[model samples]
Target: MNVNHSNNKITETACKITDEICLPDSDLPRIVIIGGGFAGLALVEKLKHQEVQVVLLDKNNFHQFQPLLYQVATSALEPDSIVFPFRKQINGYKNVFFRLAEVEEIQADSNTIMTNKGSVSYDYLVLATGTTTNFFGMDSVAKNSLGMKDIRDSLNIRHMMLQNLEQAAITCDDDERDALTNFVIVGGGPAGVEMAGALAEFCKYILPKDYPEYPSSIMNIYLIEAIDDLLSTMSDKASSKTLKYLEDLNVKVLLNEAVSNYDGNEVTTKSGKTILAKNLIWTAGVKGQFPKGIDKKHVVKDNRIKTGSFLMVEGSKNIFAIGDIAAVISKKTPKGHPQVAQTAIQQGKWLGNSLLKIIKNESPKPFEYKDKGSLATVGKRKAVADLGKMKFAGYFAWLLWSIVHLMSISGFRNKLMVGFNWAVSYFTYEKSNRLIIRNFKPTSSQTKESGQYES
Candidate 1:
C-alpha cells in the first residue's frame, strides 16, 4: 500500500484519555501496558494480584477479540459479541487501573511513558500494541484498502461492501455496476480465507434471498494472494480441502499473485490482470506498531520489538513486550511466537507470574508459549481444525469451532447472544442483523474517519 499524508480532520478520535492518577506513592512495582488488544489485556488479567500496581493503556476502553472481528465486519456476529469492556474486566481488582490513552513515546532513561492525555512513570512497561496492516508500500492499496486490525476497520469494510451493493443496484453504467459487484480481498491467512469464504456464502445464498432485484451471480469475489496457498500454517490436506471448497462455491482463488496496485476503481495484479472492483479489503501483512524510544535493532524484521526469553526489551529490563509486539527469542522459537490471541493470553499469564516473582524478590523466569492448535471456519457448516496430531474438517469441525468460540467470549450474555445467532443462522441460512444502520459513503462527510470510535 502507498503511504501518504493522513487528513488531520479525524485523527484525534481514539479516546479522550484522563490523567494517570491511580498509582500509589509507595515503591510497589508498577506495570504499564501499551495496548488493550489480546496480549496486553492478557497481561493485565494475569497481573491482578498483591504487591504490584498495574496501569494499562490502550487507544480504546474495550479489549477487542480481533480473531472474530472479521465476523463483525461481515455481519456474522454483532459488535458486543467480540468486544469486552476493559474497565469492566478489572473493575473489582483494586490493584489494576486502566487509561484510554495511546502511548506516544517511551522515555526510557526516566522510566516514563508519554501519552496524548499525560505521562506516567513505570517500574515495568509492556509494549503489546500489536500490528497494523502492511500495504507493502503500494500507494494505491495503502490509501484505498481496508485493513482488519480492529473493530473500526471491520465496520468500515461492512459499510463499504453494503454501499457497493446498493450502488450497483441503481447505477446505469455497466462498468460501474460491475466494479461495484466485484470484490477483491488480498491475503490468504485465516482472516482473508474466512472473509472470502463468508462473502461467497453471502453472494451464493443470502444476497439472492435479500436482494431479489439483481441477478445473484452479479457478485464477483476474488481472493488474491502473493502466496500459493491459504492457511499456510495449517496442513496441506486441510489447505487443499479449503481450496476445493472455495472453488465449489465459484470463488476465484488466485494463488501466487501480488496485488500490484489498486485505485478505488480497479486492482491490477502482478500477472498484469486488471480486476475492476470498488471493495478491496487488505489483510496482506502487518508490521510491529511500537512507540518511539526503542532501538532499531531491538525492532525485528516486521518492526516487532525484539525481547529476551523473559519478554523484556534487550536494553531495558523493567520494560517488557509480549504477543504480537514482543519478538521473543527462545530455543523453539528463535524469533518469537505468532501474533495470535492464544499467544497473547499465555504471555499475559507469564508476565503476571513474572511480576509475582519480582514482588517476592526472586528472578523472573523465562516465558514459554503453549500451542493449543488452530482452526478456521469457512462459510456455513464448512471448517477445519488442527490439534497437533489430529486434523478434522467439514461440518463437525465447524460445530466444534462454534462451541469453542462461544465459550471463549468474555461475558455470559455475549455468549448466549452469539450462540443464539449461530444456531439461528445455521438453521435458517439467514443473518437477522444485516440492517445497514448507517449508509456508508466513501469519502463523504458521512463516512466516519479512521480514528473515530464510540466515546
Candidate 2:
C-alpha cells in the first residue's frame, strides 16, 4: 500500500494524492479510521502493537461519554467529568496517531479520504462515524428545538434551562413564568426518561431551595413519546414500572403523541395540542452521518451504509463501516442491530481481529452481537433492567445502573469526580454546578451543532 508522505509528516494533498498532512513512510499497511467514537476507540485498543500503521481522525479532540451527557444538562455532573482528551487517551501508543479534522468526502476507488485539512490514502478504511440527530424532515423542529447528542448540546441545555429558570424567578407575569419554567422533553427513550426524572428532581430538591421566590409547583416537566409506552425497547413490565416511577415523580407523561412542530416558544403535537415551553429537549432519533462520494445505492434507511455479513461496505473491497453508520442485514437482524454503544464496541473489536485474520489470508468470522441486556435509571432509587431471562425494576436496578455507568466512564479522575458529585447530590439533594458557565442563545438554524455531538 502507498501513502503520500512528505518530511515524515502530513502536509497537503495534490491531484488526488497527498496534501498538507504527512506521516512516516513505512512498509506496513496504513489503516485510516474515520470517527473517534466508541467503535473507533475500541478498534484502536484492539489494534495496539499491531504491524499496520493506524491513523484515528475525529472532528473533536476529546471523546465525551454520551450516556452521562444528560447529567451535565441536569447539573448532576460537570462536563469535564464525562469528556476525556483523545490525545491523552492514546498517549503512549507510538504506532497510533490522532488528528483533528472533518471528513468531507470518501474516494473509495483510490482508497483516499478528503478531510478539511487534506487527503490521505488507506490500505483499509474503517468508518465508525456514528449518528446525528434525526429531525424527521421537520425543518421547523430542527431549526427551533434543542437536541441531546453531544456535550455541547448538554451544556447548551444546562445554560438555557438555568437561564430560563432565572428569568422565571424574576418575571411578574404568571403565564410568562409558566412558559419559561415549562420544560418539554420529546422522545421517551432512556435519555428523555432520565432527563425528565432529573429535571423533576431539580424542581423537588434544587428549585425549592435555589429559587425561594418562585413556587416549585409551577415548574412543569413533560415527557412526550410517540409510542404507547416509555422505553418501548424494554419489556412491558419495565415500561409500566417506568411510567409509574415518572408519574410518582410528578412528571407529566404524554404517550401516543408525536411532536409535529416547534416554533421556539411553542411545541405543537400531531394531535393539535400546543405546549408553551421554552425548552424542548429532543431525544427522539438519530440517523447515520457520512461525507459525500459514496454511491447513494449503498446507503440504506436512516442514512446508514449497508454492509455485508462480514461487515464490509456493500460495494467496496477494502472499506468497512461499523457502529451506528452500518446496517448489517441478516436473517436474524433484517433491519440491523439497535444503535447502542455495545453494538459499536463489539463490531469494532471483531473487525479489528478480523482485519488481522484477513491480512494472514485466514477466514474472518461473521459478526454476531451478544446482547448484554439494557438498563435505564429514572430517579433516586428508581430504575429498570432487562437481563433477558430476568426483568427487574426499582432500587436495586438503579444501583446496578449507577455502578455500570460509573465503571464505563473513561479515566480515574473523571470517574472519581463523577462519583463524588453523585454521592454529594444523593445526600444533599442539591447540585452546585447549576451555574451557567457559558451563556447559549440558540440560532435560527442549529442550536447545539458543535460537531462533537448533535444538538
Candidate 3:
C-alpha cells in the first residue's frame, strides 16, 4: 500500500522515505484492528471473506483463552492448550493479515497508527486493545505481586509457585518456610475465586504427592476481598455458596478487608492486619488499554473510550472501539455495558455484520448486549451458575461451566488437550507436568528483601 505523508512536517533538504509497514496493495477498504482478544478475533471471523481487507495487529501472535488461566497457573493444564496462534486462526482467510507489533500512538487526523515496527493507515480503525491489570496506584504491592492478565503472567505465577515450593522444602527456618508456602489472592471476583480454588486443590491433591516433606496443611491459601461477599456480581446464593465451598476446601476467606501494602515477605491490610506471605496474586481490578491519540474528552470511567449505540467512537467518522476498551454510554446503560467476554464477542460480531452496510451508507440496527449469564468454579465438581432467572450450584453447575468453556476454546487441538487433562484429573487427580524450564525472577524490590524466595 502507498504511504500517506501529506500531513508530515518535512523539510525540503531532508531525505524522504516511506515509513509505512508493507502490506498487500488492495483497492478494498482496509480495516485495522489493534487486538486479538475475543472481540477482535470475533470481528475477524465475521469479516474473513468479505469485501474489506482486515489487518490485525497485536503485541502477541496468539489469542489466549483467559478464563482458564488459573488452571495453567495451578498446573492443571499446560499453557499451549489455552493459547492459539493468530496465523493458524486466519490460515484460510485470504483477506486477513496478521502482524506482530505494539502500537505506540494513533494519528486519527491522518487515519494513521504508529507502531513499534512502522506506520499503517486504515480506512476504518477498530480499537479492541482490551485491558491491563489495575493496581490502584499501590507501588509497593504492584512491585511485589503478580497479576494474571496474560499468558506470560500465568507462566510467571506457575514458575514462581513451583520455585517457592522448592525453596520451602529446602529451608529449615519455620518463618521463612511459612512465608514461602503461603499464598494470598486479592479480590473476590471470578479470577480471584477461581485462582484460590485451584491453588487449594493443588495443596490438597498435588502437594501430598510431590512434596512429601511438608504436610499439605503447611501450604496456606488465603482469599481476601474488599467487599463483604465473594462473587459479588452474582446472586446472594452464589456468593454464599462460593464462600462455603472455598471454606470447605480449607481456603481462608477474608471479607471486608483490603491489602494496603506488601514488601515481598509480608502483606498488610487496610484494617491494621498483617499476614506473612511471599506469593501474592492480584486480580482485583483492570483498566482499558489503548494506543494514544483518542481525544481525552471522550475517555470515560475505567479508562474506556466512549462509543455510540452503533459502536462508533465519539467524535470520529470512521474510528470504532470494541471489547473492554469501548464504553457505550446511554441512558439505559449509564455505566456502560459489562466488560465481559460475552459483551466483547457480541460487540465484535455486531460491528462486523454491520460495517459493510455502514460503508454503503445503510443504517443497521444499534448494538445491543445479551447477557448469557455467569459461571464460576470453586473446585472440582463444585461451581455456581446464574443463567437468567435460574440459579444453581454443585455438580450440575460445574458440568455446565466445563462444557461451555471447553466448547468456547479457539482450536480443536486445545479443546482435546484440555478435555483429556480434565478427564485424567477427574479420575486420578493427576495434573500436568510441573517442570521449571527457566528461572523466574521477580522485580528488584521483591528480590532485595528475600533473595532465597522471590515470587
Off by over 4 Å in 2: 1-18, 445-455
**Clashing residue pairs, candidate 3?**
none
If ranked by lDDT, best first, what sequence of candidates would result? 3, 2, 1
Q: Across residues 1-455, which tens digit of lDDT does each residue of candidate 3 receive? A: 24432322111232245687767666678999999998999999999888788999988878899999899999999999999999999998878889898888999999999998899999999999888788888989889999888877888899999999999999999999999999999999999999999999999999999999989999999999999999988999999999999999999999999999999999999999999999999999887878889989999987889999998999999999998889999999998998888899999999998998987889889998999899999999999999999999999999999999999999999999999999999999899999997888997434121100000
Question: How do the residues 1-455 of candidate 2 rate in per-residue lDDT, one tens digit apiece?
Answer: 44554323333333345484566556678888888888888898888778777899898988889998888999888889999998999997766888888888988888888989988788999988888888898988888888888888888899999999999978898878888999999999999999999999988998888888977898999999998999998999899999999999999999999999999889999999898999898899888888888789999899998998788998788998988889998889989898888899899899999998988889997999999999999988899999988999999999999999999888999999989998988888868567877777888656434445211
Residue 407 deviation, candidate 1, in Å? Answer: 1.6
Task: Rate residue 446 of model 1 by lDDT.
Answer: 21
Estimate the TM-score of every prediction.
0.91, 0.95, 0.94
What does each candidate score in C-alpha RMSD?
8.1, 3.6, 6.0
Q: Pick out the ten consecutive residues of candidate 3 with the lowest summed lDDT.
A: 446-455
lDDT, residue 120, candidate 3: 94
Model 2: what TM-score? 0.95
Q: Supply candidate 3's per-residue lDDT for 38.
A: 87
Candidate closer to the true structure by TM-score (higher is better), 1 or 2: 2
